[model samples]
Target: MNNTLLPAVDTNLVPVYAEIFLLIAASAILLIDLYLKGSRRNVTYYLSLLAVVGCAVLTFGDFNSGATVYTFNGMYVSDPMSNLLKLFTYVAVALTLVYSRQYVTDRGMLSGNLGGEFYVLALFAMLGQMIMISGNSMLSVYLGLELMSLSLYALVALRRDHATSTEAAMKYFILGALASGFMLYGISMIYGATGSLNIPDIAASAASGAADPTILVFGLVFMVSGMAFKLGAAPFHMWAPDVYQGSPTAVTLLLGGAPKLAAFAIVMRLLVEALPSLAYDWQQMLLVLAVLSLAIGNLTAIAQTNLKRMLAYSTIAQMGFVLLGMMAGVVGDDTSNMPAAYSAAMYSSITYVLTTLGSFGIIMMLARAGFEAEQIADFKGLGRRSPWFALVMTVLMFSLAGVPPMMGFMAKWAVLQAVANTGAVWLAVVAVMFSLIGAFYYLRVVKTMWFDEAVDTSPIVTPTDMRVALSLNGVAVVVLGLIPGALLGACLQAIEMTLRS
Candidate 1:
């Protein structure tokens, strides 16, 4: 069973205690939930929230202490970027739980005696993401990715009675497994070429012209394919719409948020950190991926009647923008612009997830028992009933559509700015065009909520905490859009400190 633990220095284990604490907390939540009365099940919920808070505090404190610290023989690490990303992940996951509580309860996922598996699995998933964000080696990255992927599969299928959910779970499991295999095969190829699974070693090998060029390129292609799939970028984004539509909204919220950060981390770790010498090849691949993703994702989303599917495609297009920013990193091999280019992509990813967290939170807010609120039509006349939430949704839509004075606009602009700085004006132009095209559906959602006649006319109900969170989230989106300097600077500094190769 390999119970013998690997020896780790104190510095390596410094930030690791947080992961251990979360593991213990998750197990505690599971055990504690088993004995609690159904009426007091909220205890587990609060405990989960507390655990997230605890982790956030720990990560935040760690961020101020140093810029980079490697551990576990360099398989794990802590740095400004990882710490900042972890802080965001904790907040995102906590907010997901808050928005999802009523939805799960109404569906009997937690109320009708569904076990605490949902909460427990969520913590485990967060743990996996944290690991991925901090992983410094191929083995650690793969392990973290699989851990997160497996938890999501279970979460999507948690409602065993929902046939659509079960179907989505099966499809997700199959596709996710294939993606993982592609990544693993690519890792093996890279290992064969460079004789190293460590990111820095791979970079050194590739840079020194020591690795087999053909094998490196081949591995790069497969790795990009796998990453594209994981990020739900085009040509590999087929599963998103179905999965989003089929899963419970709570699960959808979890799926849509936080994980993107982990995916971005892997991108930074593998392609950016491990193979910058192969930038020309991977950059071209990302170009194709970005163009296709924006085209197909935007063009297709306009026709979606389901809100979830609409957001699904929107995700693909947004990821295209991320690719554009990332591809700009190695222009002309000057390497001087790498930090801003990489940080632009990082900030873009964070902003997109932040906006998405709010958007999906509102979707969950509008939904109730017997009404999934899955359809665009379901939002008709929402403004009349719940103007506050309607306003929130409107802001979210405008942001997603990249309208000015909103976070989505700023996010898209940051990426485009980075791309344009690299003289990829044509790519920027295409991205902006698709963004315009994609606005139709987002604007459509906004219009339905504000202008259409009342269909349900039900009263709006939401928890006080969620209401507060929603307000703050919506405001943060707009405010950050207006003033993104601090956060963008933070991202740039993080990249400079940790990934300035």
Candidate 2:
């Protein structure tokens, strides 16, 4: 092997320094946490939040306003899309730590029993997501995926004493490993055919009809299958419910929340960016996946008695809507509308993550010592006990149901509009129908909270900081629902910038 270094002047490290800072910060936190004992470990917790916030600031400051620029020999990249996604990721993660703080502390995660591993590992996972978001090449994408997956696998089993948590961790690790293998095999096939792992080169080869169609399509199959598992889409979604149900609520939120943004980025790279020439082929596959996801996710969610498990299924259905918007971009080589299509999906992805973050935040808030708060029955008297939280949960439920007067409605509407624009009316219709079906379960939760009598009669007490954060998080959902133009435009602009590059 030839050992060579790229020109110093040509390497653009400026754009990726946020991720580097995250790596250093996480390492420093790990070392600092080692010396802290008991509740004093809250210092590590605070530092984790600070680290995430600092990364957000760094990402914002370094947001490139120009075209795509490659760094690290073109393995890493900077673009408006990545910049915007990274910003959102930071927000999701910071908010996650806020919501999870009391929950973990109550559960012994902060008392030196679980050590500071949760915070440290979360920071590391955040780094992985940042890596995945900016990855420009196959090798980089694989690296990011493994890093994020490995962190999540550990997080699920953070409560090692719990049999369910340990079982969930094992299931997730096995499934995740298999998915990774599939993705790697697909990458190898593409590399074999194109002789390059760079996204742009693979795209060029496909566009020029230089790569063998059979090989390209076969690789795409494995790639999409792998992506389906990561995104928790149906037929490949077996791991989500078990993992969501068995993991601690705080860890569950981390698994379900910010990672969706990275998953969307992975899809964008693998499908939209690297293989636009094969859009027609993959679009059909996505269509099937979307329909199955909507059907299985919604109908199955209706049967789930567990709140976390229901949300797991809801995540699947929500991802279906995202896929609906994504596959609408390519209609017989007319890629002019690709930005709107991709951006609509991006908007949906971001909205779903934000809404899910708040919903799970509330779930964690409801939980107390020795109580997991994982059941629909647990929310029976939420309205009587905590009207503010009940209302917040209501907003999230309505949003997830795609009901009017909530951000979720606008998200679904935007994606449907994008799909309709591409002449996919049937797809939009299927989505709406499943969305209506999905509404039943969300409405059921609302009914339980507002109308049913108390099951436990426990008071919901939360910290001032958590209360304030939850209020702001809920308010953002409502405000964004009412005025989604700015965010919608931002999404469009980011994708437009990417398309230009």
Best by TM-score: 2
After TM-score superposition, the amount by which residue 78's alpha carbon in candidate 1 deviates from its true location, in angstroms, is 0.3
- TM-score (all chains, Cα) for each model: 0.97, 0.97
lDDT of all predictions, in order shown?
0.89, 0.91
Highest-lDDT candidate: 2
Clashing pairs in 2: none
List runs of model 1 lying over 4 Å from the truth.
Answer: 1-11, 111-114
374-483 in candidate 2: lDDT tens per residue? 99998998998999899999999999999887899999999999899988788888888889889999999999999999887766789888999999988999999999
In model 2, the runs with Cα more than 4 Å from the true position are 1-9, 64-67
Candidate 1 matches the true fold with a TM-score of 0.97
Superposition TM-score, candidate 2 onto the true structure: 0.97
Which ten contiguous residues of candidate 1 have the minimum total lDDT? 3-12
lDDT of 1 at 162: 93
